[model samples]
Target chain A: MGIIDKVRKVSETVWEIPVTYKEGMRAPARIIATEKLVREITAVMDFQSAASRQWMWA
Target chain B: MDVGVGGVISPGGIGFDINCGMRLVITNLTSDDVRPYLKEIVDLLFQRVPAGVGSHGFLKISRQEFREVVEQGARWCVEHDYGWEEDLELTEESGCISGADAAKISERAIDRGYNQIGTLGGGNHYLEVQVARPEDVRDKELAAKFGITIPNQIVVMFHCGSRGFGHQVATDYLQIFLKVMESKYGIKVLDRELACAPFESPEGRDYFAAMKCGLNMSFANRQVILHRIREVFSEVFGRSAEDLGMRMIYDVAHNTAKLEKHTVDGKEKRLLVHRKGATRAFGPGQEEVAAPYRDIGQPVIIGGSMETGSYLLVGTSSGDQTFFSTAHGSGRTMSRTKARKLWHGKQLQRDLEARGIYIRSTSWAGLAEEAGAAYKDIDEVIEATELAGISKPVVRFTPIGNVKG
Candidate 1:
């Protein structure tokens, strides 16, 4: 499973997206209830993470 | 949320605009006095106080002067003749936070804030001329102490923050922490957005120092805006700000983390109190509260949605469980984009105007985005807040005239 599946949600309000999901992601990404407010924020983070990983590989 | 000492200090937790807050200025003028020249007054305020995105402010300070603003905060504005000396005493942190090392601020940060002082940045943030609705004053003694004895007494409240400078500071630090989180600190976070170092660590120390600069910058920003607001009032009323009793009620940051001493287990303990979208609701007898209001309590301004009336509340001793903190405002029930889709700015503007509330804005679309329906009912929220024993309402301020850009 890729990084998205590594999410370990502690509760409804908190979840941890682990480093194994994305390379060089030094830390996990925690999503609180507020993160669900706008999909755009998570989308931007995903795009940035992918771009940064590509750059690191390049 | 408790950020462990020397633990991670998340920029996300502290918020991007570090000390983004509100300022309340009291005036002796009444609704009757302002009714005659409401349009002219709001128009003059709109002309004087720059609002909206990419707005330039009055003071064009050099890089060095910018550093002074970060170091001295609102005191810098007072020293430069933008504010009076007494204003500082009424402000949270006395209008300045010490340990703000401007050196922690980047050249990029300086450039972003160099000319933005005195400008009210966009969205939700506004400059409103409100009148104390007589019947809404809960604690008559507290209201009187806050100079709100007379019904329809005028007051001005403006909300803004460190603007681009604070944004850049948060961005820069997040990157630095992300790079150093594992290597230097041997610390891992639950999220990259929660990137932080130990408070005692070099990175943590630097972040706090830089964050303090953002706090200071916000105070300076509000001070300059208040100066401009005073100018507008003075221009319209044909009286000096002093004669108009345009004194500061209080200024408090809704986003900030401070090392404050609070009682725990019946013993005073120092805690790294970080309040994002929350404010300090210090009860009576806290030495930090200004002398004039020391016996009363710290003033807490809860900004309701633009249409609904805002409130002036004071902390309660019962709020100790909350670390003397309370909700900053009525949280949004809907998104801005969604609100814009549901309401037309022109129609909303007309509807508000018909209610005797005169408002000026640069973008009607932005105005629509701040529709009253977008937020939770402020009255209900305030009732819940007081019922929670966090704070007690003092005076209800209904917006009569407001300016936005």
Candidate 2:
């Protein structure tokens, strides 16, 4: 699965990426950003691969 | 939010103000003494001390002198006769934080800071002439030790920071890390805006060094402003500031990251502690607390809005668990936009004057955004911190005259 597919919403303005969605993960990572901001956030974040994915957490 | 080891240092962690913090000075003169010339004193201070966004400062120094300001911090101002030598001793880190490398700072940062020294940048920063009451004196000896001899002891308190210099430094480093974080280090971030490098990485070391310059710049900035306050008082009172017994109580910075030694699990460890809105409140007997104040603990200044009052607090032993830190100011209860929507600046200014609070601000809209009601009650915040055993209250100062940016 793509990194974006692993994203989940925990609350408004907060998103979580579950540990099970990725290898060698111990805990989920959370951020203070909305789903819409997720794409805008990646223009610089996805330096290793060219990718885009959108998943509805709500 | 804890950033892990080798994690990047985001400019957002400390914000643009850098070492933006508060400085409190206690005077021998009483409210009665100043009230007669209160208007004149405030007016002169408002003129002598520059406020507002992007305002130029009084001192016009050479580029070499400017570099010294960053390298020597507050000491640069004192050596140049800006403030008394005693003022330096009372200030944390003696106004100079080691590890500051002016060479590490970007040229753009230099340009922004060169003419902006000694200024109170816009957005809620202020210099106020206040009166402390005896009724609110939490510890009489502590207050006395702090040079507050009586109720109505006229005091001057101001809040400011590194100004545009720090803003430029944060911007420069953030951009640098954004480019190198994933490419060179293979680091993945939770937020794109939260770009950072390892604390020991080449990028991290350079940023840290640059950050120290920003801290020192803030120290020098406040030291110069304090000197101006003394000058204004000396002129208004017809005596030297020293003759008036006007001396600095203390100065504290609320932002920045410091590598400090702390005891954990009964073992001493050094950790990089970053406090954005919190300040060092080292309790009594701690070596880091200033010399004269070592027995009493570090001074914790909690600045409130114009209408509300501010407090002077001392660190306590019980606060060690939280790295001996406490709140820096009366936390905002309403956002700036919300407060502006609630009231007009002109009306708020008139209302504050009616209540005996004199205000001189660069912009009325800026003043409205800083409405006292928009902040958490300072008295209550102090009370809670005291009850929580993090800090002990020293004195409560109500503003009589204010100058804001």
Candidate 3:
């Protein structure tokens, strides 16, 4: 699945990424944040190339 | 809470100054009585009380006598007529904690503590004049119980510590603990600032004793300052301290370690309680609380930055969960260097004067370090603690004047 498809919606302000989706994962990734806050938070991250690489792998 | 030998030094454990603390005193005078000479009174205090970094008090003593002051705490001050015997009852640990061995304290610590007995050191150390809130005045039952009655009754609140003495003690032990950490005890540390040994170890015992000496030294220092304050009031107003009703409310230490029994996991256990940047907020009926304040619980004095409002809170039973602890003051929001860089001392003083808050300080840089804007909203922090069931607010006090060190 694509990176976006792998992200599971948990609540209005929360999201979860399953550990099984990654090979070296130790625990599920949990993010507690509003959509706007998440967008602002992600804007500071270097995620474009990583997301493209993940999509290519899928 | 357990610091097995070789733990890293965490700032949260020892804090900036090892035993920085606060003391609250309630007076019977009404606001109107003090209002007329508020400026003069603050001026007199600034003149009579030694302040700023490395300030020395009027009294001088031999190293042996100074060691006795550290060993006996406020009791030594009381014996020397700096304060009354009744004041001891209101202080935590009755003003003196056992195990203050002069031998455990270093010569450098002794030298630093000698002349600083009644001095108010720099940084956040301050003396303030405050009036109880109207709501507290209306609650006659509670007011009567806490000795706070009559609207606009003046109270004195100050925060200080053992000065250079406490710093040296913490410094000396931090080095000693660091040396023993790798060689004697193979313990890894996450932070060097949190350096500590096991509670039962010899090194731990020595540090604890020295720490108690620092605690005692602070109490005695404040006790002496209280006497000087009384003398200043008498000189300015032509009335004795008793005539002015300058009675001590309570004195509590913020940074120190003590062996306390608390219920953990549904079982009672003795734990070494280290309250760094925190105060004990024991609930009502706790034997540790003073007799008169037992029903109301221990008084928790939360001093705000000079420009903000301070608060008087009471401990609740819920505090048992956190070893009866609460935040000591409004936590700093900005670094001191940042505050000093952002604001000028003269401009800050002018702003405070505009709000009718009189201020006197020894150093302009010290004043900048304590700018109210440098701290978090005290009201919000107190609310958070109340919501978390650690303490309950009793009354809010807005500062009319302040003396900074």
lDDT of each: 0.81, 0.81, 0.78
User: What TM-score would chain B receive for each of the candidates shown?
Assistant: 0.97, 0.97, 0.95
**Model 1 over residues B119-206: C-alpha lDDT tens digits?**
8888878999998977878889888888777778999998888999998999999999899989987876545776767776788889
* Number of the candidate with higher DockQ, 1 or 2: 1
lDDT of 3 by residue, B96-134 (tens): 888888889899998888998888888889999888857
Worst 10 residues of 3 chain B by lDDT: B3-12
How well is each residue in B305-360 modelled by candidate 2, as lDDT tens digits? 88989999999998866677777887666668888999888898789888888888
- Which clashing pairs does model 2 show? B8-B196, B8-B197, B9-B196
Interface RMSD values for all candidates: 9.9, 13.5, 12.4
What TM-score against the true fold does each predicted structure earn?
0.86, 0.86, 0.85
What TM-score results for chain B when candidate 3 is compared with the true chain B? Answer: 0.95
Fnat by candidate, in order: 0.00, 0.00, 0.00
Clashing pairs in 3: B8-B191, B8-B194, B9-B191, B9-B192, B9-B193, B9-B194, B9-B195, B10-B193, B10-B194
Once fitted onto the true fold, the runs of candidate 2 whose alpha carbons sit more than 4 angstroms away are A1-58, B1-8
| DockQ-based class of model 3 | incorrect
